[model samples]
Target chain A: MQTLAAGPPPPVTPLVVIAIYLGLLLALALFSAKLFRGTSTDYFVASRSIGPFMLLMSVFGTTMTAFALVGSTGKAFQRGVGTYGLMASSSGLIHAACFFLIGIKLWAFGKRYGYVTQIQFFRDRYESNRLGYLLFPILVGLVIPYLLIGVLGAGKTIAGVTKGMFPETFAATGGSVPSWLTGLVICMVVLAYVFSGGSRAAAWANTFQTLVFMCMGLLAFYLISTKLGGLAKAIEAANGAHLVRTPSELEVASKAGTFTREVGVPSWMFLTYMFIPLSVGMFPHLFQHWLTARSAKSFRLTVIAHPLCIMIVWVPCVLIGLWATAAFAGGIEGTKPAALNKVIGGLPDANVGAVLSLMVKGLIGDPVVVGLVTAGILAAIMSSLDSQFLCLGTIFTNDIVLHRTGKNRFSDKQVVLIARSFVVAIVILTYLISLRGGNVFDLAVWSFSGFASLTPLVFAALYWRGATKMGAYASVVAAMGTWLYFFAQSGWGGEYTVFGGVMPVALSFGAGALAMLLVSALTPKPSQATIDKFFPKF
Target chain B: PQRLIVLLAIALAILHQDFWDSDALVFGFMPIGLFYHACYSLAAVCLWALTIKIAWPRHIEDWAEGG
Candidate 1:
């Protein structure tokens, strides 16, 4: 069985670094809180005070959760370089398209109407109170799993890095930090910031975390590659193991003892993966971030720079994962360094989420470097968690509590209090559910698929004046119903794809779009007043 | 100009498939398909910058700012 590296006990440097990082975030949140105007709007959307740079960082940071870092690395290890082509490049294009087409328009509406949640805009556009009621539960349902992904990833990553540090005390957990404790601490750190300063804190924290993770990702990439003999040598080793083979060629290679795993991504699956990035258009957290923008001009930097940022972050991670296969193969053949072999002695197929963490720990000798990289990974996870927690809170307060009790029924203080209470509740619930554990990448893809299915509604709401409330209803029902059915049909399996190659997102998105078009054509047009309000003549 | 940018975006999407480079390696090491995408992403960044300059819906911004 694989075990932590033998020798002297691991140092506490990584744990210390992570603690200091969390402390800095708390300090930043406290500083942001001092600047808070104490109004619900200021709390929820930062009073639209965010400028271009911060807005770019926050939106990009929030969209990239554990799904980008931990999940991508694990997936790349399981698959190959094709993993980057599947998600990163497509996301670069599609995500920017959403930011340009959907984000700006929604920001305009929110600023004009004093709206804080997506359900408010949908309710006003469709002129249906019942729609908000329907959407609130669905949006919250999807976000919970997303929150779980972050929490679970944090636990697994921290535990993986800190292995052998507490050989006697944490002997029950293989001398690593227990996931439950790590998860609880991460939850509390995130909750402290979001509870104190809301969106502004999230934005500030995201900007800082984004910078840290990017730099540290590069550092880890350089260090790991240098340790593995260099990028060219690393790639050559992986190639010799046939680690780059496509799925169709994998069986033959494996039978001939040239490949050890079916590690290639298929073509159809790659094409369909583009649909997953459309989830951004319908992300409630992203909607909240949009409303925080100071102006539509603020989005220009985001739309243009986002793809480049994705490239910078994803290339290193995907390469690191690809190199891991070579490293492991070489270790088995006695061709690798002893330290590297000690940590990653076996294929991590059973728990691929730990692959990136193991690679960092195995290949990098300096405790400080390992600590910095672990902190970077945790930053990526918590940055997204704070925004999600705050958005869910904002939705519950505005769409459910305030909408049901009547807006005039509560003072600003009471409203903020209600939002805070719900945020706390969600943080606890998500933390609890995360303990059940599932694959981070698979869970994230499933969550994004559900949101992507709902993108048609956002598109129609913004641009299509003829889109009726019934059409919106039909679109949502058809999309979510199909999503749930396929999710069940897959038996909740992470590898489940449609037609043996396509992602389930293709079917869900199609069902939703078709429902929107047919139902909108059959139903009465929206009122002229509503159309004029939403799509005013210049 | 707006129509041109939209067409260009569609073109970029199509170019993203890069199926021909699937098995080839660049620089004797890097997967050619992956390198193609790295370049493709950079191209997207340029395209989007051009879109912002030429195809942005300034009218909506004007309305929002003016209001």
Candidate 2:
């Protein structure tokens, strides 16, 4: 296994590089703030001024969070190459479908009616203020864990890469900056920009960060593969080490009594995993990003290019994770083999979140390269954080605050102030909760499953004019209730599947869709005015 | 064109379940299942670009942009 030198204190170059990267991001935020229009519309949705490339960047950036980079690498480290097929490729296809099918329609609705939050659209579509009230807390509850994933992931990556750099000063944490401190700093940095320029700043920062991470991801892929003796050699080594097995291979090996691991991702699980990516269809943050488009034409680039972007970022991370399994097959050097036996410590008990960082630090020679790659990972994490923070704040201000205390009561500046205050409050709250860390990948899957279950509501709203208020209410209640039941049954287990092989997302999504269809069929159709408003004839 | 794109997307989704290639490898290194999906993602890119050029909702653009 590859290893850094054992004796001397690790170089501080990576930390300095990361500090510089943060400074650059803060500077970019300040620059964006100078261009801020200082209106609630501008603050929440960039005043619908973003064009194609920036729109594509921000949308893709926000979607590709710690879950994609840190979480996928960790999952691949534990699960093998099937992890890529499980999420990345399916996400590439489904996320683009959502952008084309759901995103464009929602953007049109938002522009036509001056809507800034998803709850606002839901309330109007269902003609029920109570529906908005029901959705607000549920959406907020689901998003908190998503936000926690980013915060926890950023802290893990930063600490893992910078370990042993400050041996004397931080001896307690194995010479590493603590995860809590790192998380706090990350929360504050993301808050700075989102508070300053809101959605526009987030878009600008996401564009820059997306560029940084994609470039750095490719660099990390090349460097790590080279360090492990090239891509072919790395794959060959992983295959030989029994770390890269397909489901059929595992099945055959099991029959021959040569393999004992839990049958590499079952065919049923693999097929049902497709439902998880549909979560993008109902992502509140994505809805906000969609509303930022300058024209319907702005979506063309996003829809077309997003799949390719997923390919670029995900392929390298998955390959690196596969390689890490082989590279560390003999266990991490200088640590006991039994203690650090598996590459990422074995499934449910593993600190899988730090596998990518551990691989980067252990193999790469130059601290600067490590710093740049760490910054890249941090960029992906923070980019999503900014958008989620802004969206949550937008939802609070628009759905709850303004709805309760009439919109006319608050001036435009006051509305912005309310949003900013909520952003700060959520940032602090997420940071505090992040300290009680959980598995990044599992938390993300649970959060995404919750969102996926609600997609039936969005689909019905846009396509079926018969969808009524009661149907919408029933859909939300059924979906979330199913989600809670499955979540409780799973007991927060990482590889929790329903019916032995199927993902819980499939069950939740089905329950929601069935309720939406059945209830809508039994109820009165939506008013003609509402139908005409949402589905105008050309 | 829209129908074609929708049909193509559904076909692509079905093709995504590449259980047949699970045990095969390409170039003695890359798993065939993973490689197939990589190719599948690229195919999606092409199809989506075509959708934008041929089947994009022009009326929505016209309305939003005041064309």
Query: Considering every candidate listed, which one attains the maximal lDDT?
Result: 1
Judging by DockQ against the true structure, name the best candidate. 1
Per-residue lDDT over A1-538 for candidate 2, one digit per residue giving the tens place of the 0 to 100 score:
1223456777889999999999999999879988899999999999999999999999999998865676677677666777877898888889999999999988988988899999999999999999998998999989988888788777777767767778888899888888889998998888999999999999999999999889988998888777767777777656333343344332212112443344256788989999999999999999999999998888989988898999888888887777666533443333323233243434332455566766666566578998998899999988899999999999999999999999999999999999999999999888878888766556678998999999999999998999989999999999999999989888864668877689999989999999999999999988889987888643
TM-score of every candidate's chain A = 0.94, 0.92
lDDT of 1 at A482: 95
Against the reference, the lDDT scores of all candidates come to 0.83, 0.82
Q: Estimate each model's TM-score.
A: 0.94, 0.93
Pairs that collide in candidate 1 are none
Over A238-285, each residue of candidate 1 has an lDDT whose tens digit, in order, gives 633334436733222221234345567778888898999999999999
Q: Per-prediction fnat values?
A: 0.60, 0.54
**What's the DockQ of model 1?**
0.59
